[model samples]
Target: MLTIWGRINSHNVKKVVWLGEEMGLAYDRRDVGGPFGMDEAYRTLNPNALIPTIEDDGFVLWESNSILRYLAASHGGEAFYPADAQRRASVERWMDWGFSWADAIRPIFFQLVRTEADKRDAALIERSVARAADLSAILDDVLGRQEWLSGDAFGIGDIPVAAYANTWFQLPVERPSRPNFERWYAALQDRAPFRDVVMIPLS
Candidate 1:
């Protein structure tokens, strides 16, 4: 069985766990970040001291997006990670975009979700929210033309983007309405893996 080390509430870890669920892969996830505290042994598996480090039958791997690509290619076939060069590159493009957006929006997420109101940086939060909205608008435009980031089908591209979207939509902030983004997110709601693994209450 695959051993996944991470706290479930972590966004990065959620990407991996959700992908595993979508593929119906049996795996065990250990709590290692946040209040759980990191273990020395876990550090050896992932030098970054990150929440998610998967050991698949002793084949250890770190980095959430890398894990997503691996699991999809290994088990989910072309449906999850396309075999075609251009198609796979398309998925990779959005995966990269997701990380970029994550960096932009994380400050807002940390301010509202992780920090107490009294200690929060109001200015930074506002800036981050504005930046996030700008980035998401770009996605909204792309989504307006395509059902999924990976073109017509839901594939590896959608996993990371959707994982981040879960946090974006849940945050208690004023957000401009992006109808296309909303429609795509609604479609994700119908997936069993999304509902069960990615839609949990934010920590």
Candidate 2:
């Protein structure tokens, strides 16, 4: 059995858990980060003390997006990861974009949603909101033409972006009217895997 170490509320962890559910892969999850507290054993598995570290058949892996790619390739094969070179590259670009956007917007999200109203950094949140909106518009345009990020079929590309999108939509900030983004998000909401794993209360 595979063991996942991370708190359920974590976006990175949620991505992995969501992938497992999507692939119908049964796995055990252990809480170790956030309020759960990390120990030496957990550190051994992920030296960075990150929230999502997985042990699959004695092979430990860290990095949330990397883990998602690995699981999709190992379990769902071409369906989730894709075999076509152009399709795979297109999906890979979205995955990479997700990480970059996360780094750009996460600090603002942390300050705005995760922190108390009294402790929130208004200036930082304002800047982050603008940046996040700009970034989201780019995604909105891409999703405008297709049902999924990578052409007509859903694949690994959707996972990482959707994880962050959940956070964006859940936040109190005002969002632009992006019909395409909304349509795509609505479809994801209908999925049991996404609802069960990614659609949790924001912490």
Best by lDDT: 1
lDDT string, candidate 2, 19-62, tens digits:
89888898999998889999999998899988899999999999
Off by over 4 Å in 1: none
What is residue 173's positional error in candidate 2, in angstroms? 0.8
Q: All predictions: root-mean-square deviation over Cα?
A: 0.9, 1.2
Give per-residue CA lDDT, model 1, range 1-203, as digits (tens): 98899999988999999989988899999999999999889898889988789998779999989999889887899889888998899899999889988887788888898999899999998898888899889889999999999899888899888998988999988889999999999999999999888899988
> Which residue pairs in candidate 1 collide?
none
Q: Which lDDT values do the candidates have, in the order given? A: 0.90, 0.87
Off by over 4 Å in 2: none
Candidate 2 TM-score over all chains jointly = 0.96
